[model samples]
Target: MNSSATPVAVDMGSSSVRVTAGSFDGARLTLSEVARFPNEARTVAGRLVWPLHELVERTRAVLSAVADEGMSSVAVDSWGVDHVLVDASGHAVAHPASYRDARTRGIPDELARRGLTAQGLWSRTGIQPDPINTSHQLVATLRQLAPAERDDVARVLMVPDYVAHRLGAEPGWSRAICSTSGLAEPGGGRWADDLLRELAIPTEWFGDIAPERQVAGHFAGSSDVPVIRAGSHDTACAVHALPSAPGPRVFLSSGSWSLLGVETDRPLLDDAVRAAGFSNEVRTEGGIRLLRNLTGLWILQECVRQWTREGVPTTWAGLTRDAVNAPGATALLDPDDPVFQTPGDMPARVRDAVRRNGGRVPESPGEVARVVLDSLAVSYAGTVRQLANLTGANPSCVVAVGGGTRNDLLNQLTADACGLPVAAGAAEATSVGSLLAQLETLGEIGPNDRSAIVDASFDVRLYEPRASALAGLAPPNLERLS
Candidate 1:
């Protein structure tokens, strides 16, 4: 690797794709955004599908631009589950379906009707059953595809892997990202052969799972720049960037979805863990991240979207200020309510949920936002307690990372609700982690040096718990809420 080489991280988020370039000055890493593009799935022929060609073109343009700026190595990470199917010639068979598509609406139930019970599947994969999982999506996809169209499918790659494959990497599945698909075995060792056999999915579509931090191939147009596998799952990449600490680590990768979990040496497959709504995913550094995937800021985002469409656009600062000044919430919501899952009149659905739960309905946007935030805080606390019970490790502090860390009110509320201090930072954690992995692979940095680099590179805000805020509130029963 050149001493002046710059490594890049491509973070493919559900809402946007960000390309960040990193410069390591021996002791610390400095990052800058080189490109950002809106990434949204659209309705095509009455089905929701990702704009695969457009995304690839934009990404290639950005990577080519960075190549001209002395790029070294690059890696890509994205949300998991959704995948792309390609023919023998590596051409995509069709646009990848969005995880939010309605095709998977009753696939889980359908699987159960076919004698594959949730418990049976969980025991095999150690993944929480969800309609959006790749297993369910594949089922829905096969059911809708003509037999000839299905036969043309020679390979299936997770979104990140597909992107990397298009960029000249030898076709392969990164282990960290593969774990997100319920079709993989625990810790992403291999495909669950028995499960796939029962699901009737062709085993040929999958290949060997590749470990992270290894060079896959060179950039398509630039042989000097290696495309590395730096943790393909976005959450795994974010967790990789966390400052190394000694005790039990509880992290909240807050974003559109809030993933609350702790790292463990192995998957926790107990029925209690499954009943508690937790799933075990593989980590970039080897091990399992036992987490509860809860609905996070999406509710608030939906509320804001509704307001904007109603000719009453609201800014984040103004909404937060108003929420802070508004009266305390008289009603609390289960943010994971299915009614709030899809786009539409979110505010109305929130009110309906409150009313159905026998609580006072919130009429104003500020009040509604307050309820959502408070409810999330309570849910976080409950999940923390559940973690303690499930793992028997006392968490030292709550480390909040990603976009939601910027919300000071929610951070403080989380601290209070959990009765623990909160350390928030690394808003671009996915990029940071990806950069670290790239540098390590290039021999510019070592594993033990990541903590020092993170400490030098970012500012961490600490929020102390305010015991008074927990006076009358209890961590809502998460099991009941779901």
Candidate 2:
């Protein structure tokens, strides 16, 4: 790699795709977004599927545009679980199913009917038995295909890996993203063969898991720029940018989902952990990210969408301001409530949920938004306490990352609810972490230098807890919503 070369991180998020270029000086790493575009899955032939071809073309254009700027390498990171099936020629056999697709809706129950209980699956994969899991999605897909068509399914690549392969990287599963699929052994970087056999999924479709930071091939096939597997899973990449702190580090990768958990040295597969809906996902540097995948900003986003459709558009800034001034939420919702799962009529659904829970129904949009924000904070606090109990390590503070950190009301509420100071920043955490991984892999920075660079490069604001704010909020009880 040239000394002045820049590494670009292609962050493929569920809602958007961002391509950012990073230049690291001796002390600070400066990042600038080269391109960004909206990314969303749409109904294609009665199934919700990602715009894989469009995404690939957009990413390729961005990379090509930046290729002449002394680029050293490029890496891709994206949301986990969703994947694309490819043929021998490396072209997608079909558009990748969105995790939100209803095809996997009852697959878990179907699996249980076959004697593959949720606990059994968790024991093998250390992943929560969610229908959104890749294993369940594969089961649904395989059951839908005829025997002859199934033969055409040559490889199952997670979204990032598939994108990288399309961009000229070698065909290989990146470890961090593979770990999210519920098909691989927790923290082991190997496919769970026993589980695959039990699920009747073809074992040949998967390849060896590649390290998070390794050169797979050259970008665009003929370019000198290398395509690195730098923390392929978005959460793993975000966690990579975490500033070093003592004791167990609790982090909230707040986005469409509120992934709240602490880093562990190994998978915690005990019954208690599973019972609490916790999953042991793999970290980029090799460890278990023991966390609960909770519902996050999706509800609010859905509400905004519906409002816009109803001829009343709402902006994030206005919504946050309204939520701040609104009265306390009369009812606390379990963000994971099934009612809020799918998009459409979100405000009405929120009111229905509150009514069902015997709480006052919110009449206005601000009130509805307040209910969601309050509920999320309460849930965050509860999850943090659960992490401490399960791991036996008291965290010093809560680290909140991703787009959700921009909401000051939610950040302060989380601090108050968790009863801990919240260090919130790195709005582009996934991209930052991917860049850090690329820089480290290219020998531009040492392993220990990530924290210092992150601190110097980003503006992390600390929100102190205000216990008084918790007075009107209801206690967290995940079971009530379940």
Candidate 3:
């Protein structure tokens, strides 16, 4: 294994795409950023869709920037569920629809109409039934297409798989991410055959399912450097980068969507798991990620976008500082509310939700930021408790990773709300984990020791739960809403 070769990790997130180069000297891994660019869904012909060609172009530009850096290999990971439909010639049939698109609005009711329930699906696939899941999206696609058009579909590739295919890798599905489709069987590479038959989906639409850490192929022009299948699912990669000793520790991959969960050797498939709103997604390493998807920093991110559109461009640090001293929990709206999921006038929506909840409406940008952060913390706290109870694993601490960890206010509030210490670090976790998985595939590092390598590679900022922050705020009782 040549430690001098710097491997590349491409993280295609919902909001942005980032590339990192990692230098591993057979002992420690050091990561450096190569490129970053914003990615947004576009409204074309009255439909919201991902700019697939534009994304491919940006990724190529990023890869080109590091093409001369003695690059050993490259791997990619992306947000889960959404995929592209390709024809027999490997051309995308159409622009991929946004996960938040309204096409699948009545999918749950449709499933019920067919006598297929969430519990029935969960028991077989271990995926919680979400309208945004690829299964529902495929259904929408099928309904939108004529029977002749449906016959033209050859493959359905998830976002990262599509990106990886463009990089000259074999067209294969990463089970780590495919698990989120609500179609794959838990802890296995096989698809849920019965579910697929029931939904009238062609089993041949999916190609070979690849396990994590395998070399898919070489980059398009390079023969020596292998492109590894490193989780492919962004949250799976982020969880792989966690620097924790073998112990009871919860992980919160906080970003646009806060996926808070724990890793287990087997899927927790039960009625309680479904009732608790926790999803059992497959892990990069061999296990299940029992977690809940809480609406995360997206509310605040949208608010910033709105303010910038109104000629008040602001940085996250600037907004955090402004809200740091603002009143806490004066208004608390459920961050997971359906209205907040779609993109729009977020600041106004936050204010309206707060007012509707009998709390004071945010009159300023700072107040709006504070309300969003406080609401997110409240949701995180409640989800953590539910995760613990469902899994029966009382973790000693919560490991917060990704972009949201930099927000001091949210970290402290989460710690206070959960009554547990928080260790936040690895802001570039998804990329780092991708690189680590690549390293393991190249035999530069052992598979079992990847966690220890991560533990020694990065620094962590610790926060102890402070009772003062939770003094007056009432923790969100989601159960009461049920």
Candidate 4:
């Protein structure tokens, strides 16, 4: 099999590294799987850190298989906000702690005491102030380290950059992902030293944030297989596949996490957005990504995992169907409740929450699954409305992407909940977006050509909202009004 006719893409996620190859015949690209490696996080010394060295090894091993199979070019991308600091020798100084670790607690307050208040930070950098941000983690880690070791650190490459470095290349600080760390100057592409200083972050913790689609570097060992930055941020890559063209549109990448927002020409950082939990992140072309951090499938996945462990098989499909058939809004949950923050005893917690909310605890697998899915869709509906109120951009439709899109129940719930059309498909939105950037980087396509390209390669699932289904959000004293 002569492999000269295909191209490939590499995607790094919080849990796995996947690569796919495709042939671009001037119109659309047809992709083939190259590899998937076991990638996950671990608790090291009580902190959750991604297995960095192991991740790189698996990524290279997977891509190398594609290299061996033959490919024209490769582009790399991953989840943003977590980084591994490499000494001048390009070796990680310490395991990169997981953003979910408890160590990040109070760092937000520490930044404020140091005079990096929410307003000050946003006015200076435009990033939303959140404890889970990399800046907070960097500060928390620095507090743990001896001051001497901090200054000697050479490169603070985000995870993707770290992997790229080991791939025998100069890692890039991509704009797409950098914006997520709450350190970048929001709509701006460059890192702001003044903001870092105010936040007390060392200059060495970050690199120049660049648009990955423009720069080219050779794969460390394979000169014939050069790699492009390709947006470098997984969420941005996911948004790249959303059906956004010629109108106000929102892309909701609902997976283990739910990213709900609209692409903006500028940052929306007013009191409205701030109060509603909306963040302004930068997109691939330096576009503003006004979204929120909504705890998504974690609840359902956790509950399902727990039930299965307890001898009850609860598939998402089975659960969602039960919810669709069950009574609507019998219980409402604070989906962002701190209890839901970390994993453990999700089913119990859900039962407790239902009991606490004056509702009966779910007694069966179907009831539990139904509650989880309905809650997620309701959360999405509420979030969509809030985003619109924050940015004043009432998007006509919601473009639902990623693995969560496969949930027809959740998709319909969102449609009925928000009373807006939902376009869901390309369960591989993140990878496809990654591949889209790869295609652009290879000069086989243009970025703005996304609409036609996506239409050709994907089957868009559209769900129209019925005025009658939105009654779920009200006081329940009334029926859904169209």
lDDT (10s digit) by residue, model 2, range 1-482: 23454899999988889999988776777889899999978998999999989999989988988886668899999998999888889988877889999999999899999999999988988998899999999999987877766778898999999999999899999989999899998775899998898899889999898888789888884568999999999999999888655555699998988888988888998999998889988888888888888889999999998999999968999999999988874677778877788767999898887877766788888999998998999888878877788778888899989989999999998988878889997988989899989988889888888898888888989998886465335443455222
lDDT of 1 at 116: 90
Native RMSD of candidate 3 (Å): 1.8
Worst 10 residues of 1 by lDDT: 473-482
Residue-level lDDT tens digits of model 4 in 1-482:
12124656677876567787777566565667767776667788888888878777777777777778676777777776788877888888888888778898888787777767777666656666777788888889878877677766787888776777787667668777788777777675788787777666777666677776764577766887777777777788888877644467778998888888888889876765665667887776567778887778878877776777888866666677777677665665667777777767798998887777665567776677667766777777777777666667788888889888888878887898888889896887877777777777767777678767777777888898866444346311112110
Q: Which candidate do you rate higher for lDDT, 2 or 3? A: 2
**Deviation of model 4 at 117, angstroms:** 1.9
Cα lDDT of model 1 by residue, 191-291, tens digit: 99889989999998999998898999988988789999999999998888886554777999999899999988899999999988899899888789899
The true-versus-predicted C-alpha distance at residue 142 of model 4, in Å, is: 0.7
Per-residue lDDT of model 3, residues 415-474, tens digit only: 887788889979888888899888888878877777777788888899998875653354
Report lDDT (CA) for all predictions: 0.87, 0.86, 0.84, 0.74
Name the lDDT value of residue 391 in candidate 1.
87
The deviation in Å at residue 181 for candidate 3 is 0.5
Global lDDT of model 2: 0.86
Where does candidate 4 stray beyond 4 Å?
Answer: 1-5, 146-152, 244-247, 321-325, 467-482
Worst ten-residue run, lDDT, model 4? 473-482
Answer with 1 or 4, whichever has the higher TM-score: 1
Q: Candidate 1 at residue 407, lDDT?
A: 89
